[model samples]
Target chain A: MSLCEAEKTFILHGVEENFRIDGREREDYRPMEVEIGIISHAFGSARLRLANTDVLVAVKIEVDTPYPEKPSQGKLDFFVDCSANATPDFEGRGGEDLATGISNSLSDAYRSSKAFDLKKLCIMKGQKCWKLLVDILLLECGGNLYDAVSLAVKAALWNTRVPGVKSVGIDGKNVELNVSERLNDCVPLDVSGAPVMVTVCKIGEYCVVDPSAAEEKCSSAALVVAVSQGNITTVLQGSAGSLHPTTLMDSLGLGVEVANQLNIALMETLQSAPPHFDVGFLK
Target chain B: MSRKELLSKIGLRADGRRAQELRRIRCKLGVFTEPDGSAYIEQGLTKVLAAVYGPHQVRGGRSKAQYDAAIVNCQFSMAVFSTGERKRRPRGDRKSTEMSIHLKQALMATIKTELYPWSQIDVYVEVLHADGGVYAACVNASTLALIDAGIPLKEYVCACTASLANNDIPMVDISYQEEVLGGPTLTVAALPMSEKIVLMEMTQRFHLDHLPKVLKEALRGCKDIKVILDEAVRNHLVNVGSSSGWVKNK
Candidate 1:
């Protein structure tokens, strides 16, 4: 969706005036709606819609042997699928590049042990562990994909329930574990330290958070910052154009501030909603 | 071949539904604004989203455009986490490609392609959840999306799945449990208003003598589904009409 020179000038002027095309302040985000436990097949799932950009994340747990180097910690894998329903450009292998970018950034954001502790997934240390597969699906791409995907992923992990191990037996070279059969016998993952990403787009001289599709097209450089517990876990510079050092520092600060507020708001929403509330695309 | 019976002694299926009953179908049209038309549908636990983009000038290149009719392009995809087991890829797999071709065939049969010559219509469906009858759900959702796009159609295209139980009783709308129980499934997509079948597919082989009955049952299910969809369209029209104040005709 290319814009004419006149349209870009209009958006540039809007950002400079502290008003966006949607009449939002530079720091304001688009209205968001999030639903938890939307996918019944997964152990935990979430769907988040930020205006038109929609993201769905589901966490599936499986039993596997821990990695030899990281024997005491379980695994966390992220997969992203960009659907053609979002756009014809995402058909077949067209969206592979974008999917890989998003998944890789998510892995980097969660790589820090302070941001996300993997030890909780361990079932029997090196012998057995719970492997969590976090799959993200992009149903629509209005704009601000990084923010929406990160928020949805955090919610999904918070809802995930790792089954309790009833017993573990070792016999020479073989190790066996019995998972609790009762549905209630499970533990929810602690997500207080999970990072929330914020994309700060540099438009004209000002940095705007949560840019719409048109706004995104107008900006040439941006910073994607993932914040966890008031600290920055990951900072990815996405610059199509060179950024001044001062502007880059300014944007990073703005990203962290916005991400912290977003994390608090997300936790409040998750806490207020009942566990069995039925909500999805229908609502 | 001894296995658990699909239908219980009381004639209830595994999901506590009757033999001829369908799973609950709840659908909404115009779910997304970016697409020319979009729809979301839930058939029990199976959910699907469909979007239609065109009837506009051909994209990518001009060589693919046909002069006589609007080209129908279809893509079928499932979310990576859609199934009980995580799928490695969303689309471009063998099964997804086959479903895409079948979807194109079914949609082409109902759409009035001659109205938009030298143009293309892009229909994309994504399965959010896959319990059973994923193909049937995609077809139904795409039909609604096409309608929402205001495309000209001969009639609504509906699809349904039917299977034989006890080698005699034909069942309508098989679920995942039923599909896994080792029964032959007959899937049919048709223009129910005119009782014309556009596509028919089967998974397993059954006795040739029982083919007609199962086929008949599936067609009947399609017709029933069409009625439900028609009612939904009328209700949607009324809601839209009232919102736009179209009922002020004196």
Candidate 2:
């Protein structure tokens, strides 16, 4: 993704003019295409394509005993895999760093009880709990990976369905639970408070959301802010160059503002998603 | 693990296809703009995507470059949700590493590496779903991606899986259900025109007398795949040519 000096200058000047090379406003996000229930085997799945940054998320549920420290709460685990199809650099264990970084940020964003509630996943007090395993795979890297990954995770969690427990039997320290056989007996997860991350990249002096790969190369610093219902849940700074405190504050404000709007649009789109017609890479 | 018959009395497979019939194959080339070449393929329930990048200076270090032949590096990975049960890791696992090595071997036999000395070509395949014959699908998709990259090849390399049904009848293109039901699976990747086998692997065991028949069925399947891929290449060229107005000029 090397940009020549003149190309960098062109992008820097374009940002200073309040317009990006692709004619997008500084605060505007690229058109995003999202598909739900793409993975059949998983309890819930979603694929999000923000221009070329492609992400696929799947949520799998397993019942297990709750941790002694948190007997009333279930568990949430995030795993990220950066496929080599995105780039040769991600082959084998090469992408572990980036995958770990994204997964950790997601863990942090979902840590606050306001953003996600683990208690709802509990099946029984101190005995059985549903563990939600959210796995995200990156097929392509066009930049703004944090935002794309976060959105896909949220969508997947929203689509998740927890099987309903029909009965629980306790006999001699052995507890057995019967899950309902009916398909509609499953419970949909509560994702109203799921966080949505926005990447505010500072290109020259102007901060932009959803920076393209070319713009990302020109920028020296960026702020990733996760917002849940107009409240900031997590903030992480990725700085390739130093930034003033005032500039950081400005970027954070813009990130939260854009994230709130983005959240509304995402919910609307998910609500009005078209009926399934077997969509995937084939289409 | 059901005792249900794999092949019915009429000779139809579990999916209702004849023993000699391969599953439906649908493929598209140049699916992504970022990669030098990209392709997506669906063989029945198994779906795969392949991307090719290279014929340029080797990254990392120059010592890995070959003096007389180009380096072919391949990585094979599957999505965590691709299998019936979730996979803990996509790659770096023993199965994936073995698949990657086998993929590199099959592709190296077809690509013309002498023309681009001191360079490397990276072929990466990601499986979106796995219902069986995943390796074969990866090989096919990588060939299409290499073609889209305009890399020279001696001939197209295609792979197919075959197994013995009812302990006697040979079947082509074994699905996940068939593979699990029981029987030895013989996977062969070869150049159909030359009738040269680039790589071969057999799982489970059968009578020595039945080996030739199963191998022949697998090879025949590869040949059939080559025909389908050749047709796809021609159709792709026609579409690209027409869209570029090359055909109109003529």
Candidate 3:
């Protein structure tokens, strides 16, 4: 999707005027739709579509020994898969670099205890604990991938339910856990503190949130800010272009402001969402 | 471990489906705008999404381009969380590579590649859930995607899986549980309109005498699937056409 020089200048002028190509203001976001518990086989799952960008997230839990260094804490791992269906460029191993970058940023954002507590996922100290594997699939890329993926991940984690442990038996060197068989005997995850990322793109002296693919191309640099409970968790600088110190700080501020608003809106939608239905891609 | 019956006394399968009945198939076309054509299909518990791109100039290098016919490229992938157990990788495994090759073969049989010389067509299928018959689901989903892409094809290509329930009774559309159980499964991809078999694969050896019956059942399943896909395509066209006012006169 290479842009011509004149086309780039057109986008630049639009940003300067604070009116985007899609007739949106600099701070406004595109329409988004979120669906939870769409994947029945997964412990938790979510699908989010921010304009044309689509992300699907699923969380699977397994019982495993805790990390030796973090014996008292459970584990949370993030894996991102770039499906070729999203674009032919992502075929074979072409998407690995992008997938790894997204997953790494997600892990970094969730590393802080204030963002997402790991102790709550612990089952029995160092012997056995629950491990949550968050798998994210990229079905479409309309730009603003960081923000879309993070929101989907948070929604999926919010929908996750950990099966209750009936009892734990320990004998010298062996530990056995009896998981409850009842479907409703489960503990839902607390995702109030989950971080939500916002990508603030610096386009022609102005900054914007949720840039469209074309807007993303016009931007020189971008800042990804992951906000959790009104606090910044992780900040990443993307693209090869350099940002001035003042501009970087300004973009950071904008990112946090938008992220907070997004978090509130996400919570409202999740809480008001009805029970699971079969409205996935069919809709 | 005690063996469970694949079919009940009254000829019902483990999932309460009759031997000839297929799992519920719900599908939608043009699910995404990024690709030239995209589709999502759910065959019972198994779900698959497919997207088709091009009939355009060959990518990567021109040396790979064919002067006589377009190169048909296919990639088969499964979401890491698609299976009961989490998968470590989505694609690039031996099984996925084999599936990709098989998909390409099936699609090539139906697609009119000679119409676009020195070009390429990319078909990608992603399995969101793998209850059973993943390969068949992929083929079915890809066919819809190609059609949505407006690619030229001789006829619709449909795939199905069949197995011998009790060494005598043949069953169509085997589920994951039945596949896990001991049984010989046969997969067939065919053009139902022309009654041409594009590809056939079998797992676990069965009596050669029973091959004809199993193959017949699998082909029948393919024909049935074709009907369903045809109906879906017509419904999609009618909706799209009327919405654009192109079919208003009719």
Candidate 4:
């Protein structure tokens, strides 16, 4: 996918004209399609397709002892698996570096209590708590992975239902918990404060949101901003290029605005969809 | 044996399927645009996606390229959440490595490797759901992906699993529940047109006397699967051809 100098110049000119190569404005995002509750085995699941980049997320819940320092709060772990079906380059251990990068950024974004409250997942202080394992599978790489992964993760978390505990008995350093037998008796997490990541790619003199694969190659650097409730939760700089302070500030502002809009649209879509609706890969 | 009965007294299996019956198979070709060719198939609850990437120059280094025949490389992976219990890792385990080698063996037997000298064809299969017959599903899906890539093959390579039910009756296309119910399962990959067995693997060995009937049932299942896959390929070709105005003849 190496682009010649002429192709780079053409893309630069398009960005300067406020129209991207894909006929999108600087802050315009590619049309995204989201489906939830697709994986029947998982506690929660979501599949998001942002143009050609497809991401599948599934959340599984387990009961484990809470960390000593965070006894009152539960644990949330993110794991990313890059499937070879996405590309031959991801075969075997080739995609490990990229997978780790994405998972690390996600954990950083969700670490803040303001972004996602982990206390609700706690079942008992220091003894037992729920652990949410969010597994993300990358099926395609159109570009802008951070944004797509974050949105898909948020949707999966929204779909997660923690089994309700009817009773918790503790005696002599032993804890016994009774989970409800009814399948529908569960608690859904409050994801209103979950962060939505927006990648602001700097191409030429303009900043672009949701850069296509081609545009991404032309960009000197990019900023990944995770926004929760209109506040920046985590900011990550990617690529080997540097950004001026003013440009960084501008991209940050743009990232927050776009992220806010994306969050609203995502929530609306998740709420409007019918329960138990599944549009798997068959479509 | 404390195992539950795999076949009831009425000749119906646990899933209500009769002996020699295959699970419903649905597949689609060219499911992804990035790969040279891609296909997705679902055999009952087992879902697999396969992608073919080469026939170009070998990757990594030129030293690994074979001068006589093109290398057929295969990788088999399962999603962590594909099973009833979440897998700790997607791949790199001993079981996956064995499955990868077995998959390559099956595909290599059908592909015409000598046609493209010093090149390589990489086939990757990812299991999204693993109800049973994961290896068989991978082989079937890879065959379709190779066909979609326009790779030359001697014939359609189909795989199936068979088990002895009620000590004499043979059942085809064993599911995960049946596999766990304690039965000797035999898996066979074959080229149905030529009736050549590419690979045969068995788990929990049964009496050698019972092998012939089980193997026959598996081969029959493979032949039936070949018919379904062949029809699917033709239908897919028609749809792709028609959509691009390929109907107009010179």
TM-score of each: 0.98, 0.96, 0.99, 0.97
Backbone clashes, each candidate:
0, 0, 0, 0
Q: Once superposed on the true structure, which residue ranges of model 2 sit more than 4 Å away at CA?
A: B1-4
Tens-place lDDT per residue, model 1, B1-250, is 2357988778888888898899999888888878899989898888999999998899889999998999999999998888887788888899999999999999999999999999999999999899899999999999999999999999999999999998889999988888999899999999998899999999988899999999999999998888888887887788788898995542
- Candidate 3: the clashing residue pairs are none
lDDT of 4 by residue, B21-132 (tens): 9999999999888889899999999999999998889999999898899998898999998988889999999999999999999999999999999999999999988999
Interface Cα root-mean-square deviation for all models? 0.9, 1.1, 0.5, 0.9
Relative to the unseen true structure, what is the C-alpha lDDT of residue B239 in candidate 3, on a scale of 0 to 100?
Answer: 90
Question: lDDT tens digits, residues A1-283, model 3?
Answer: 7899999999999989988889999999999999999999999999999999999999999998999999889999999999999889999999999999999999999999999999988888888999999999999999999999999999999999999999999989899899999999999998999999999998988999999998899999989999999999999998879999999888889898899999999999999999778899999
Candidate 2 lDDT over B1-250, as tens digits, reads 1366778888888888999999999988888878899999989999999999988889889999989999999989998889988787788889999999999999999999999999999999999889999999999999999999999999999999999988898999999988888878899999999999999999998899998998899999999999988888888888889988887543
What order do candidates take by TM-score, descending? Answer: 3, 1, 4, 2
lDDT of 3 by residue, B87-161 (tens): 999999999999999999999999999999999999999999999999999999999999999999999999999
Superposition error at B250 for model 1 (Å): 17
Pairs of residues at least 3 apart in sequence or in different chains that clash in candidate 2: none
Please give me the total number of clashing residue pairs in predicted model 2: 0
Model 3 bad stretches (over 4 Å): B1-3
Worst 10 residues of 3 chain A by lDDT: A120-129
Q: Comparing candidate 1 with candidate 3, which one achieves the higher lDDT?
A: 3
What TM-score against the true chain A does chain A of each candidate get? 0.98, 0.98, 0.99, 0.98
Q: Put the candidates in lDDT order, highest first.
A: 3, 4, 1, 2
Best prediction by lDDT: 3
For candidate 4, report its TM-score: 0.97
Query: Candidate 4 lDDT, tens digit per residue, A1-283?
Result: 6899999999999999998888988889999999998888899999999998999999999999999999999999999999988888899999999999999999999999999999998999889999999999999899999999999999999999999999999889999999999999999999999999999999988899999989999999999999999999999998879999999999999999999999999999999987664448767
How well is each residue in A1-283 modelled by candidate 2, as lDDT tens digits? 8999999999999899988889988988889999999888889999999999999999999998899999999999999999888888888789999999999999999999899999998888999999999999998999999999999998898888899999999988998999999989999999999999999998887888999999989888988999998899999987568779999899989999999998999899999988976867766
